[model samples]
Target: MSEPSRPGPARRSRLLRTARRWTVRLVVALAGALLGVLLLGRVEAPIGPFDATVALRPAGGGAHLDIPPLGALEVDAYDGPLQLDLQLRRVDEVRAEALATNPVLLDGVVDQVSEDLRDAVVKVSWMTALAAVAGAAGASLLLLRRPREVFLTLGVATGLVAGTAGLAAATWRPQALSQPTYTGLLVNAPSLIGSAQEIVARFDAYRASLEDLVANVGTLYSALSALPAPGGTDDTVALLHVSDLHLNPAGFDLVRQVATQFDVDGILDTGDITDWGSEPENSLITAVGTLDVPYVFIRGNHDSAVTGGLVAAQPNATVLDDSEVTVAGISVVGTPDPRFTPDKDATGDPGSLEQSGEELAEIADGLPEPPAIAMVHDPRQAPPLDGAVPLVLAGHTHEREVTELEEGTRLMAQGSTGGAGLRGLQGEFPEPLTCTVLYLDRATGALTAYDDVTLGGLGETEVTIERTVVGPPAPDNGETGTDGGTEPTGTPASPTG
Candidate 1:
């Protein structure tokens, strides 16, 4: 027997080389096909000459439209001139003209444009798929003979494509393509184009309504401007008093509107600017600071130590916790709340509230001139400062109240300016939003009159302003009179523009 001839070493090596070559070719072919599929998936074509026109009248801000199947189309005619721009993928050429000059011709142009774009998109998408397949097949063939070179080429191409896509994704904004200079209507289907035109007409009518609204607002502003300004005396300084905003952004707008309408010289905030005293809640300070007048703030239980720091950073804000500052000719002092948590009954350490009141009283005693006004978060804490200050302003009760202390000091406890500070939004029964505008005798720094403005609770829209006079007789010599005070006389007032 020939003892089963064993394969020679050369023959075995040849067989191994062939097996390895075939294995590499298979992997390369699979990889090439995968890369081609990924590239193809990213390809997109524009379905245009779809016509889109945007008409914006000067009075209205603008309107936007995106016709289906096309990339995106935007027009901005806010400045009274038609500006249009169209964006589409794989479009060889696009012809657009301002249809504003000829309304009758718009429908025809849009029909032509839409049809052309649909055809182009079909052709482009098909062509792109065929190219991707052809490229993948060619790469697979090249890998079989030139594996090393083919790998290098594939890697470089993949890197380039990926890098380009990433850059485009990061920097591209669809709005950037909608420039103000481009003007035209480009679409293909007459019916679709007609719909687009109808949309523009409706938008134009809407713009006309907006124009009327703008004119009415302008007229209202003029009427307000012509009205007698506040007391018409530099001695009469108005202060907008608010507190317990609790992160309600609408409160800021309402405050600004009131301040502008009242022409207040400054703002006085008691406390509870935020609910939890967090870092993110600090953004409320920017809105508060934009009032463009002196802003005196006091810390509340909801205000953390960081809240104080943020308030201090505002240009027009002053943090007054156991501290006194003179603003708008009146000495203002503040006492922070004792509690750190949300519990109304929790006053932190047992003596903290008393201690805070004592500290504030001490500060007031040391002042050469006692503060014209003292502010605290809780009215319960106001009695300690009763005779020490003429007026004690406070929040946290979520209900507005005015009391005349035996010593002639008045404690004005304001309602929650943010409608119970978002807690009102959770329940069916929500607290109404309220704020006060105080008119002070610039000379005596005494409260002459005040407006208690109450708006609908939480989501309600009713607003009522009750103007109240502080006297049958004003306080004597800037101090409360010895004679027993009369109840404040109030009359309803309309909200001025």
Candidate 2:
């Protein structure tokens, strides 16, 4: 008779159903509470016009001072504060509240805002956890009371929350968090009010200086175009020499402007067109193709075989590495720098420089006619070609220099035309941006006269143009010519501005 009291299948089934119901309800409640906390999280809103002038120095020892959005500001002397306007458009509730409390000290305001944001985030996180637990308990109780309607309730709640979120996302337009306005003042230790006035005054001066610089550039261009030909020779050809462009798009505009102004017959580029020779960087070659004049290119240490191929493909460009080409009646030969650094850490083949020099020297020795100009990237490699070519032109050293080698050969090292090839932006003192206008004798195909134009040194925005004459190559006897010809020296003159 006692065996009749044992648990039956129906009883077991009922107990299992109860457990399942409690589990489902508990899960729904937990999920709903979590969703509630997330929905109640802090929202960012715009607070009315908030603007402050903050003085900042260079983060480290360098000439460039970065002002967000305005980019790095190149300063001649880092002895003063570069005042800039910091405008806050919209911020989270925590940040807005913090800013409202202490609007005086910029540093204090920033610190408070940061602390408040962290606290808000932490508070939301804890609330989310608590809500999740509370939601699980509440959902379980609701399911126990009305099991039939639980699914309908959950479905409606989910649809409403999802639709609301979707609509908000679709309609919401994000605005920039902050905007920086440059105020061209270099105050060493400026008071708050004094800084504002100085900023305004300096800003006005900066605008005027910019206008002057533009006017000077225009005047310089006009003068270059109108210059009289030496010895009244109409056969004289003007060639613009530039190098180490390093993907600076500004180089294109400057080159085009100079080429157009001077009626340049051709342009010689000595490589480093890109920092890294990647496929995407090949787009820069398009700018070269747009030039109306012939563009002669040779790869530098930074260039790759792929880059050379791309330059060769351009309609207006001729890749002259290890090759000869006649441009504007001047016989030109070029050899690309053999040292190839694929990445920053990868040093080029150590012996590539010597090998390349030898290869180029051999090519020069075998030339049918004396090349008017020999182009290479490294100056060290140029010495080998002495006496093989009349004039040797190279870059890599971002400084303008002209030196006569032991042989009759003359080496003209053009300064970087791309403003030291983007290294100028690294906050260090950058080499002055330079380009040369070479005037060649038509019959002789020899360099006659040249103009060296220098602009925008490191932090300086002034332009300087110097004119110099090139004497005929030294007498073939490996001795300085007894013809009494003097090597031309650069005569510096300030720009019109």
Candidate 3:
């Protein structure tokens, strides 16, 4: 067979010029389209009471929500050349507060946010498409300097944008919301992302739970506010005690509600903030920063260095691992647990628990001044610290107990603030979520009184709060002055935010 005929020099040169010309057109077109979207693809709209913006940017095809200050939540919504960016901007505090407090307002807020998000998405989509086409045409006209080439480039850009949109819509995965990846804390995940299908779905299933929380807060406040505040001196500081949250969302919500209703000066957590020390469990602790009060934490057996680090990273959080911090006019010291019970990487000696307690006691005693309160994850560590501090707090058994030691130290063992976390629901009956509100005399840092708060187990919303006044025996009751508290008061109620 004869060899294939070769093109003449003049014909080859013509073909090369044509190929180079087309390559330049494609490159300039892509560059212009990217710039256009970068400049004009954003749209701002009010989502509920929040001002949020949506934009398209170059990324590996996913959606990201920027919550500002706290952190960001990212979801794999789709695959494409461009990623979706949602930025949370100014919020109407008055309206937001009302929505959080009122269930009726929250219902309207859900619908309002849905409508606003839909509108913003639609607007941004159109803006991005137009900008891409315009940019491609402009660049082609400027560089190619040929009207025919510019027109061709505009058509190509428009086709490409539409094709990309079609691909994204086709590949959109709603399941991504179930498992989102986040930067910072995962608590602030995007409420409305993925396909538009969920926007119209009803979320009333959570209304009763929310209502129960609101009603509980209101009734509890009513019951407590009617009584006079307790203290030896007029200057008394209040603190909220929580522990064993184990990554429960409802538990965190309750914590926030109780904190707000009581207006506590600070919060003391005895640890186990997550079920597993994995990265995914960081969401529950994110709200710790939003509590708007000093959060003092001690690591429990279920906690790890990562959990402690996360807490320490928060703006209002302080983690004490054999360290001391003064909050709300009270000096506090704490020590982390000897080991994470479920840790696979390290098997710290459980036998060292007592030794750890002794070390913590020494640290507390060595402080410049005796601490008002000392913290440990397990009650096992409480004995050694009896004389080191006036009060010692610990949690680990998921039970509440108060005892006055021989050396004159009061040990307050808190229950699980998260109902022992999600594991509490695995059995026939769920464990009750419990916490306490402690009152201290500001001048002398003396124990005045405390309220033990309990929420009914999972699937139940009933709440009960018991008031225990600490002081000398009252002659009126004629009862013995035991470590067990007197003047016990209880009320039924339910809470969350």
Best by lDDT: 3
Tens digits of per-residue lDDT for model 2 on 1-497? 45568678999999999787655654565466445544432223222222222222112211333333323333232122111112233234564456445435332543554564445434543443444444444564455557554654455445434543354345433231112223332221132213334444443443344344445677676655455655455889888999887775545556787788777899999878876676656756777887889999999988889999988888988998788999978998899988776343455554676677678878877888777888888787776788788788888878889887777677889878877544554433545567888888888887778888776643455776767766554566777753323466444445644
Model 1, range 1-497, lDDT digits (tens) per residue? 57888899999999999787656655564456445644542323333332332221112222244433322334442321111222332222233234423435444554656675556444533443443344555675665556564554455444433443354346445464234221122222222213444444543433333233323333433433543333565767788889888876556656787788777888899989887676546755777666679899998888888898898888999998788888789889998887786444344664677678778988998999878899898887787787898888999878899998777788999998877554554434557677888877887877777878776553344566677766634455666542335356645554432
Lowest summed lDDT over 10 consecutive residues: which window, candidate 2?
A: 77-86
Summarize candidate 3's per-residue lDDT along 1-497 as a digit string, tens digits. 89999999999999999888777877888988988998898888777878888998889688998876657878898999989899988677787778868757776876788788888888999999999999999889888898999988997798889888998999899888656676753352232122223322312433445467556666667777765558532588999999988776667987998898888899999988976576656744777888889999998988879889999999999999888899988999999998776432345565687788899889887878888998998888888887788788999888998877767788989988887754554445667788999998897777777888887765566677777767653455666554333333333232322
**Per-prediction TM-score:** 0.54, 0.60, 0.59
C-alpha RMSD values across all candidates = 16.4, 15.4, 8.5
Off by over 4 Å in 2: 1-213, 222-226, 342-350, 457-459, 473-486
Candidate 1 lDDT for residue 140:
59
* lDDT comparing candidate 2 with the true structure: 0.63
lDDT of each: 0.63, 0.63, 0.78
* Model 1 ranges off by over 4 Å: 1-232, 342-350, 472-483, 494-497
